[model samples]
Target: MAGEMAAGLAEEGGSKIKMIVSYVDNLPNGSEEGLFYALDLGGTNFRVLRVQLAGKEKRVVKRESREVSIPPHLMSSNSSELFGFIASALTKFVADEGHNALFNDRQRELGFTFSFPVRQTSITSGTLIKWTKAFSIDDAVGEDVVAELQTAMEKQGLDMRVSALINDTVGTLAAGSYYDEDVVVGVILGTGSNAAYLEKASAIPKLEGDIPKSGKMIFEKLISGMYLGEIVRRVLLKITLQSSIFGNIDKTKLRTHFILRTPDISAMHHDGTPDLRIVAEKLADNLKITDTSLETRKMVVEICDIVTRRSARLAAAGIVGILRKIGRGNPGDKHKSVVAIDGGLYEHYTEFRQCLESTLTELLGEEASKSVTVKLTNDGSGLGAALIAAAHSQY
Candidate 1:
């Protein structure tokens, strides 16, 4: 699957999938020093962060952050309602910072991490192509998200300017790049999967002249959290129907879409007891099936492993493809390479992380694999946004 996805990305307009070109020309060079704000609107939550940078020697000096949950209705409501709530929350956050000694009179600059499908027109503007992860705001589609956010900020009387509009994956890369120049790719494995990597401007035939500085390409969708559980559920559903393992059980939960979440599957996969007690308990609790035989228990465990392993292996393949695209596939290419990865699944799930690492070693072989590393970065949507804002700040 990773190989297939890579094949699509290698061509203009793509053969199998269309990869979006983010017109973000610049990446952080660890020299940007300022107080910047970051607004990250992800699938289920929005996070805000403020960072005070002390330039190359000191890096990030001080930081403060807050996370707020979006009410369910706002996800499907009007764009104004959604952005308004976000702006209101941001206003309070900014007000609290007013007392901080680190703050200055310079006009504030922000980096907005909008994790959705967007047709980017520039560093600070992009048209929403569509919503994903169950978001369905009708008016947001085709609208410039940066503009939407800026308008909301204005309504709240927030005197701040958006300096950069970034994808989460791109933010991850920026965050990683701020610390390490070798970091070449950024991937997100939670809720939804996607990747961003620096690509040569000449390689993207679909992108015309006036390309941005960082010449990068980001895959909007791939082996991510939102679809992994569904994939596992479909496989489990087929097996349950065919084998009748539960013997006329309710199976209603199994039938429901996304009833089996990625974290649930990851938890089951990590169970290591003799009889896999945790798996049995979770199956009973989540699926309402109990008193399973050893064979049934084993089957359940195997299913979890299978689903997780496939996702991890496929993720490894995607990483390999990116490395190869950039000529890092050679055994003697000694430049230490790093792929900065972020997301709850990649961070928390040990089995998944180990499997991904082992698969990369297998794919790249010993000599070549030594140079490539998958380094986990924290808070891509928050700290990363602040970093980009600092790098692109007008002040």
Candidate 2:
């Protein structure tokens, strides 16, 4: 069903035949030398990396990573402050290392994974559409983010270039496509949810003014980790009102934060439709005492299972929607489709992965299921950004 949904989405977009290509598949095969930098800004934290690509033989070519926590104030702060912090972090990263010949002359070139809805002007520039992931920054939408980062970097004497700006989904697609010709879509089922697929430039009606010769369109932030929290919040309001623990309990004081969504999912698993006493015990772990000597093991198992199932089924529905959109799952086509799956959810949760695949199979049919394989593509954001950096470089 997921495949059909994606295909349907493509058909709606006026695609004659849905063909989702991953950009990573297009990576140049050669022994090339280039210094690349990738900055990943997502929920909770941000990471900046400098990668040395030795092309095919050496691959990764070497990498360095640094993590910085996003300040609580920044989520609600003005753009200047937010960009300033990012600029300061990047400046610190550069100053941590001395002159390196490969990227010294062009220390200005870098790739940024903004992980939010931005009206991209090109591969290198975009405007912030709005803040998601519980972020409510005013006057942020329509602001040029790349320019903001650039101006801030200069103020800090940081000699770096934001040559490419991509969404995490696009990065995943790029990274997956680099290794597998069959990988067509990149999905992040982390704190939130989103998907990215390679689309033909000719198919985008929204961008009627200009057409790139490469014929590529990348959709980011439209669906990603930042919004899942909101989705959870919406679902919980309905569930709790109908369930036991919250049916009569006043929830007016419960802060509706993005983090609460995780617990909400856990709550739904424990009590959405009753028979949740055991699971509820787990959810109330802080409220109760779990005797390790007893059935504590069983409670944990049940809690994990139910929550994973709930998350997976909803995720499957989203995938199914996209598949139906693309015309890939319809009995009318025979081409195999591959989804490049990433993120903490699919990575850490075994039951969740199983449930997701099961739901997709139930929606798409056995034949299509055989043709559709959801494969994990790890750390695609970091690697894929580097790939984008390489592609945009003159070398």
Q: How many clashes (backbone atoms < 3 Å, residues ≥3 apart in a chain or on different chains) does model 2 have?
A: 39
After TM-score superposition, what is the CA distance of residue 300 in candidate 2 from its true location, in Å?
13
Give the C-alpha miss distance for residue 387 in model 1, angstroms.
1.1
Q: How far is 204's C-alpha from truth in model 2 (Å)? A: 1.8
RMSD of 1: 3.9
lDDT of 1 by residue, 93-136 (tens): 99888655345678888999987767787889988888978789
lDDT of 2 by residue, 245-280 (tens): 343444553334553334444443435434445454
TM-score of each: 0.89, 0.70
Range of the 10 consecutive residues with the lowest summed lDDT in candidate 2:
211-220
Model 1: lDDT of residue 387: 87
Give residue 146's error in model 1 in angstroms.
1.0
- The whole-model lDDT of each prediction reads 0.81, 0.64
